[model samples]
Target: MNPSFAQASPQALVAGDPDQGAVLDAALAPLRAEFGTVDLVVERMDRLGNWAFVIGDMRSPGGGRLDMSGTRFADAAEQGAMSSVYVALLRREGDAAGDASDAATESTAAGAGPAAPAEAAARDQAGLQQEDADPAVAAETPRGRWVVVDFAIGPGDVAWLGWPQEHAAPRALFGF
Candidate 1:
């Protein structure tokens, strides 16, 4: 753990934080599923919302960066279409950059998360569900876990997490 990161409060760190890559990894895994071998990781963000300032590394075989600041991810999230919109935009980038080999590796399997952040927000079921097998997870999961809050990725958006974030997104990450 970096000393700089440990300087922050534990509660603050537990939230869906993009700066702390490992903690944020769970939230970003779905995006990775779309990337395949391309290392499209979100390195920094002034904020994580509709009008967010995002800076990320895009080593899409060709190697580059995702210099999107005022993109459409926010708008799509408002309509509960963020998932599809984001994936479509990424797919377009993959095709244009000739990253077909990596793109084809993505799977159309189950547990692919919601079609849009809006949908998850509409039915935000985090604290509401109690029958989950893991009592510890069920109790702790709802306190801070969130990625697609309020129909979009706001300050609580993870975009960095891996397994935990993905599973929690459809449930805990929903709504503001």
Candidate 2:
């Protein structure tokens, strides 16, 4: 089953330690690379088996907003001041990934620790819980290093609909 990474508010994100921050940075490297140092605040995170779903807001490094709503894809560089809901599906690093470390170690090395109880919820109440995870997901092949399975940006409703099914991420992302 997947071990959930604690959720944090936009304000709590700036309070983590350097190592923890680095881990997050590493996890988000793909997003940054595609968006060029775009600003993302993780509003929610849920780990289903080895799959993780991240929901957040994205802004430019210059503090301007970027929106990818409606359209399947949009050029971030072309637009400015468009606030958006960012959603990403991430696969956890498994033993097959060649890394012996677990997610917790990555958190520690990145200087990240648990957020304040008042500010962070352990997991999404409406999301699939550990026990409810599909057994097939735990046995899926191609398991390994962390990967950005898929991502969508827009309003929550629209973004959620954009979750891709062809990627390596578990098909049960929405708890199917």
| All candidates: TM-score | 0.24, 0.44
Per-residue accuracy of model 2 over 1-176 as CA lDDT, tens digit each: 23233332111224342223332443466555555567777775555544566667777677666544434346442464234777765544434434432544455457664333322222222221222112122212244434454556554355455342233234344434
Clashing pairs in 2: 19-110, 19-111, 20-110, 20-111, 20-112, 21-110
Indicate which candidate wins on TM-score.
Answer: 2
Clashes of 1: 11
Worst 10 residues of 1 by lDDT: 87-96
Per-model RMSD to reference: 16.0, 13.0
Across residues 10-40, which tens digit of lDDT does each residue of candidate 1 receive? Answer: 1223235533333234334444444444454
Model 1 alpha-carbon drift over 4 Å, by segment: 1-19, 41-43, 46-54, 61-143, 149-176
lDDT score, candidate 2: 0.45
